[model samples]
Target: MPQPRSHDIRRGRYSEAGRSYLLTTVTHQRRSLFHDFHHARLVIQQLRRCELERSCRSLAWVVMPDHVHWLIELKALPLGEVMRRFKARSSLALHRAGVPSQRVWQAGYHDRALRREEDVLHVARYIVANPVRAGLVRSVREYSHWDAVWL
Candidate 1:
């Protein structure tokens, strides 16, 4: 049997308002475009912009070299729409900032909706600790591109 395409895999996925989700998306070809501080900030700007627009409430986020992990509580929009807006806006921001990548993000993102019984704080910590786990910093505090509400 053949494997499902990315979109196909998400066909049955549903989004619920007021639910928290952990989202991950990669840069085109995993090019590490975010290694540049300014470029990374552009992406972060978009994340904040999305929140201000009330698409979702950002709980935690980390901008890695080639990817991003975001924990958010869905607001008015569905998960797919929220991610769509974020990726599109961030890609435009990267272009305006003079980044070379025409496609700032891959076609789709991965999302896991948090269950009520889950420890949200634990998940937030895991998201912010990505840089430490990746060896980019000796400690999470040493990394500058991550944020969490609990911190």
Candidate 2:
């Protein structure tokens, strides 16, 4: 099979400070089973650890069966470093749980920095509402793998 096009995998950069960002990452090979609700809960726990250790502030998050969406306030660390530590820790946890050795996150993640005029709370609501929007649940409360500080 032909390799996917580079454009299909390219991610943009965010260089501004004090900007809230919405980020998303998918499991390797689009494997939905790799991150079930229980695993998603664990991922959230790990993220909380990263928050305490790296000083990140998570506004909202939703962990889908195959991917995750997070809205976070970049604190003391650079966004790149924050995401690196997050992925590394989560990958290690998943590996120890017997996830495939070849399974790993993609090289880059998707991030959209909010403009100064944008409403951070609105974006956070959107992040938490992903499961409903995707038709995975009738309501955000029905989803077992989502959380937010404001909610």
Candidate 3:
């Protein structure tokens, strides 16, 4: 289970902190907005900001053309609040950066909680190799919008 679906989170389920989650959020209307380097950088900035805020610690991440996949460890907040902050702040930052004054990410994100016995390295590999899976690059090194703490 990936921390329940978006609807479940809204209904007050699986809001636990101090867990690892693989999160995915898409652009509004599935727009390829992040194909633009500036917009992508804005999202990266928000990710770092989230880490600095201590809501979550990013373990690995990949900013795709129309979506993002982030592996993180919740530190000081529930997943819902963390996601809310990320969405809100990123939208505001992007708007300030002249991307748009409207919503940037979709209403909800998908999150998968990792198990204690799970191999995190495998998950990190999956997250960082998304570009290759999407045919955006032939190798992980060619993708600039991805990072893995373990790598």
Candidate 4:
């Protein structure tokens, strides 16, 4: 097996408007930065901003200690642009919140475009269940950093 090249990340990628995608982006060096409530809320604010600006409709999202899992329906922009803006804005927000790290996120994100027949609710359940799966919380209800439209 061959290792994937960095440029291959975007190979054959297409961003169709109105399509749902699950995006995961990790913090730089996978540092558990979201452990602090304020730091985590800052990132959450950026997610809300993306929706408010009509970039994407957030179906579900969970701000884990070191990464974020967001299920969103692409709106007006391409997936790359939406992610670029989100990362930039979130980095700025973290800086403004007194987080000294200049680099908040890793270079790129992972996105899974959902097929029309896929069960969106099932996917959302899996997303919200991340905290429980990671053993950070006993139940989804106990996780403070996650949300889903169905829940």
Candidate 1 residue-wise lDDT, 79-102, digit = tens: 999999999989988888898757
Badly placed stretches (over 4 Å) of model 4 are 1-5
Which has the greatest TM-score?
1
What's each prediction's clash count? 0, 0, 0, 0
TM-score of model 2 relative to the true fold?
A: 0.86
Candidate order by decreasing lDDT: 4, 1, 3, 2
**Between candidates 1 and 3, which one is better according to TM-score?**
1
Judge candidate 3 at residue 2 and give its lDDT.
47
TM-score of each: 0.95, 0.86, 0.90, 0.94
Write down the TM-score for model 1: 0.95
Please tell me which predicted candidate would have the highest lDDT against the true structure: 4
Q: Write the per-residue lDDT of candidate 3 for residues 43-143, one digit (tens) a residue.
A: 89889888999999999999999999999989988888888888888788788888867678777888888998888789999999999999999999998
The CA lDDT at 133 in model 4 is 93
What shift in Å separates residue 88 of candidate 3 from its native position after superposition?
Answer: 0.8
Q: How would you encode candidate 4's per-residue C-alpha lDDT over 3-89 as one tens digit per residue? A: 647467888889999999999999998989999999999899999999999989999999999999999999999999999998999
Off by over 4 Å in 2: 1-12
What lDDT does the true structure give each of the candidates?
0.92, 0.77, 0.86, 0.92
